[model samples]
Target: MSYNFKTIRPVMPAKDMINVILSKTQRKTPTVVHPGYDISRIRGFYMRKVKFTQETIHEKIDAILQDFPKLDDIHPFYADLINVLYDKDHYKLALGHVHACRNVIDNIAKDYCRLLKYGDSLYRCKMLKRAALGRMCTTLKKLTSSLNYLDEVRKHLSRMPAINPFERTLLVTGFPNVGKSSFVNNITNANLDVQPYPFTTQNLYVGHTDYNFVRWQVIDTPGVLDHSLSERNPIEMQAITALAHLKACIMFFLDISETCSYSIDQQIALFKDLKPLFKNKPLLLVMTKIDIKKFEQLDPIDQQKLQDVIQSENVFYSQLSNKSGEGIAQVKEKACGLLNEWRQNLKPEQLTGGNPNLLREESILQGVYIAQPKRVNQNRMPVIPQVIGKLNRPTLKDVQEQNGGAGVFSFPLQEHFLLENPDWKYDAVPEIMDGKNIGDFVDADILQRLEELEKEEEMMDQAEIEDPEEDAREEMLLNTRDQINKKREMIKEEHHMKMKQQVKLHRPNLEDAKEDFAKKGIDTTFLEQRAQKFAAKKVLQKQKRQQQSSDDSDDNDMDIEGNDRNQRKGRDALSRSRSRLREISRSRSRGNKKVLTAQEQAMERMSKKIQRRRRNEAKAGDGDTKIDCKMPKHLFTGKSGIGKQSRR
Candidate 1:
């Protein structure tokens, strides 16, 4: 039996039986609870007993406007207050509780942090500020950020770290207020942000930690919005541009719970645009905040749904809570683990004597570096064929090592060619003249010279960056590039002319098709002329049909005017026949508004014939065969045709 009616459990009750038992306790008799105040008890009774006046509820609701202004229609907040006043437990105020709810959750979170710091006590009234249910509801409100933190912590615990200088990196990034700030604050340190608002950090801030003693840098860029590099609201393009040439892995943040909540497709599209920036670096899909999910809503972390988020095995799912440091370690470990994996997968950097490499001589730049090139035999490796343009390859110093030396080309041949050339000598050196020996230059002096060249090349390779004062130089380079492009075009034209001449020389009369078009003023070489001719031909044919129709009408009029008795009847019949013909023509013309002339039809036929002839000419072209046409020495050398035949 219980003396306190409010302390009765919801399940273990018969009110009549409890009333009878309470009546028997003339005086209070029971074991006392342990010391330290219980905050939930106070909050629970107040929640059930007290009725908030309209004035007080309105005051609290209006106070939230000062904190978060992104919300619209404060009526929802007012409605929630009314519901609390009237006891409507079913009303969900996800959008309404944005600002006010966070304060409550944070207060409760501080209690947890406090308890963790101090000893747990029943007498610690301040331990659970306001109430436990209030804490649960607030945490419920900020589910996205909370789950994201937890996920980060879990990932860090799962993956171990790699050695220093050999570690790879993953950069988690997104627009400002997308929970990136809270995410960094939760996982790394508890107090990185000075404020909880926009543009809090004016520049790029990098945080480094040695979890498992694996050195790694986590980049927390300043808040970014949905805009291009040059088309930003702030003058600070530091964060967006820093990512322009990154080598680390990327974790694109998507916070759909905010006012600027981007759709999944929009996030995926942004990923695609940013994906190329990383140049095939590993990408992780981080769906932030799992706590705030409403029961009827779809789970944001669902796999099939996330296929639309990022379509790759490189993606990872995480839920984080910055307030509690829920997934901070996991996120750090995941970032480090990815970096380490990439480091291992990175094509082993080539060993060159110029760089004072530990690898043996004759082995530098001598291994296979092809990517997924087909195998032809056991001995022959994938060949980057020595064509005119494809001859440029990564130098020993320029090539980054790739997956176990499968002969995969690590650097893009086009971008890397300007940086270093394997065939170009950095110093003045004698080449293998006609038939001279090549192994006579292996002294210590040559080795020193090579080492110096390697250091210079390494420095220059790293210098492929944006230069500010080179505007005019860049324009000059552009002009030079245009000139080179024109040269290529002229060369292409020369090739075309040569091919045509060779084909015509082999078989005459192929140019007749062009001549036919010229006679008609078609200027077949000019596509515009053909179109105009086709139009004119249609007009001419239409005019001819109209003249013929007028002439037929005149002949019928003459028969009707000069006629005997039978002739007049015949003229009348001819008039009737002409009228019927005119009616039929009108009906047919009405059926199809478009009308073409005879010459237009003929011109179309001619155009098709010309096309067929040109196609046949192309089929027979076979580019010009550059074969040796001279008679073979085995057949005609020192022998007359008659004598050779007689001998055979």
Candidate 2:
């Protein structure tokens, strides 16, 4: 896994965090509490304040805990680097304090909130709230030192170079001023200080360069001294940590000219000391400062010593001069090539732990077959035409240049059209000639076909005219069929009428009854006399009803006149008394008004002004219709306990 420590959030100091949490709680929760409020409401108000503050603190501390990389859960290279830069125990202790403080704040809030539930008065609840906030702040204040340390660590970590431990890396290390930094600057963009002193690069510096289309990370570690691990400082341990943990191509730099203040034997001894860390890793012994002193110019003994070191260590050796930039490219190429070869030769199980899914196999070779032809003595060669060698064709681009060139030159499209007659390619036929459509006559056989159709239609007409008897028989059959259809329709309508729940009965008038009786030759005088008697009876009854209604209306009018006269007298007396009272109560005003003091008059004027403004702006008043959420989702949904409803 790769890690980018630059994204760790900045840790805030303890005092600042406490103030921020308290201020946030004050701003988010209710601050006002009245003694008149119910004890439950007062307790809940304080409880919410305490809980909110604890949650705020928890969230902040949790962010720090989560953002910082855990040592036990990260890559060994980064873990060791972090341990070297910042003591492992100290870092773990600082984060542990933060985590513990977060729990303490939660417990304090919980205890205070439980006590708040029993508070009977607003004063008691308010005191509990204060106590809760104070205890949380005190718990946080105890971690001031840890918070400051973490904050400093965060700042340093954010500035640390982002290195991918799992990527192809080339680690450059050796004694101080041995041209390691200069070599890194030459190949990559690390650009370290090339001072002629030791420990110029105190921290691990990462730079990236691409080789064979794959990106490679080059880490320039601080110079290490010729001492045991216990005697090494943090600056030197950084290089040791990288060399011991990183699976990279180790380029151990050696100052061939002894210009770095370290002798050749000392550099070789340092390499031998670090040889255990280079197990199974590709190593390159890069001899820097060739311009100052060449290996050939060294004494025979020194050359023999270097050769023995190279052979004994089983490492590839090369020479380069940073000042002259001689052999720098070769050193880089050789390092990358060696690293790639080592990676390619690694066993599948070593990289993937024998996981079948991750095993590398030649999948492209599956189901592939190669066929070999039988050997023959005869010789076979490809034949070529003689004219092919002499053909020099002018391409489209050449033709375009010879013409007017690109946009101005248009190819002759008609020249490429395949037609039966080449000359017909450019021929144009008009759609209309004179007053006739040329398309209509495009087919030479159209007129003959039309004539044949006309002849067929004439023959069909003659055949029809010769068969009059058949036409008459068909007409008779159609009339008979229409009669049968009409009868069927009548029967269907009768059936529908019978199915109705209430059928309308046809009642004949007196005249129709008289006509029917006269046609049947029956005596109609008695029936006519009975009909006239019935009509006379109905007319007499209607007249009697009209006369009774007129009589009743006249009686009601008389009663109403009597009642109205009495009401008029009473209203006159009441009006006189009301006028007298109004005159006695009114103060010299145009209309009836209530007498008011100065304050009352001012209040009335203000109310009128406010009413007028409200009317103009169309604002809602106290009596306006409103819709409030009767049951809030957060309170109504999910599980609830005895006191959870009020808390939610």
Put down candidate 2 lDDT per residue, 417-524, tens digits, no spaces. 999999998877565767567576678888999999999999989877657889899999999999999999999999998896877899999989989867856667
Question: Cα deviation of 589 in candidate 1 (Å)?
Answer: 99
Question: Which model scores highest in TM-score?
Answer: 2
Q: What is the per-residue lDDT of model 1 for residues 1-648, given as tens digits with 9 covering 90 to 100?
A: 001112212221223322332333212222133444464443332232111211222333344333221223332322232233222332224224434444554455445544433434443432342244334433443544423333332343233121111123456677555666666665554356756556676644555556544445565666655556557643235454445534565767765444335655566556666665566666655656544542125454644556644446446656554555566567666766665556445444421212233233213323535466566445866666568445576555455453334366454444434436755534344569764546674575887899999999999988887777787798999999999999999999999887743433444342676676568655445545666788899999999999879866767666634445546767898999999998887755466564545665789998898679658655544464445657777877674655455210
Q: Which stretch of 10 consecutive residues in model 1 shows the poorest summed lDDT? A: 1-10
After superposition, the stretches of candidate 2 with alpha carbons farther than 4 Å from their true spots are 347-648
Q: What is the C-alpha lDDT of each candidate?
A: 0.49, 0.84
Which segments of candidate 1 are over 4 A away from where they belong?
1-168, 189-191, 233-236, 259-266, 294-296, 299-305, 312-314, 347-648
TM-score for all predictions? 0.27, 0.56
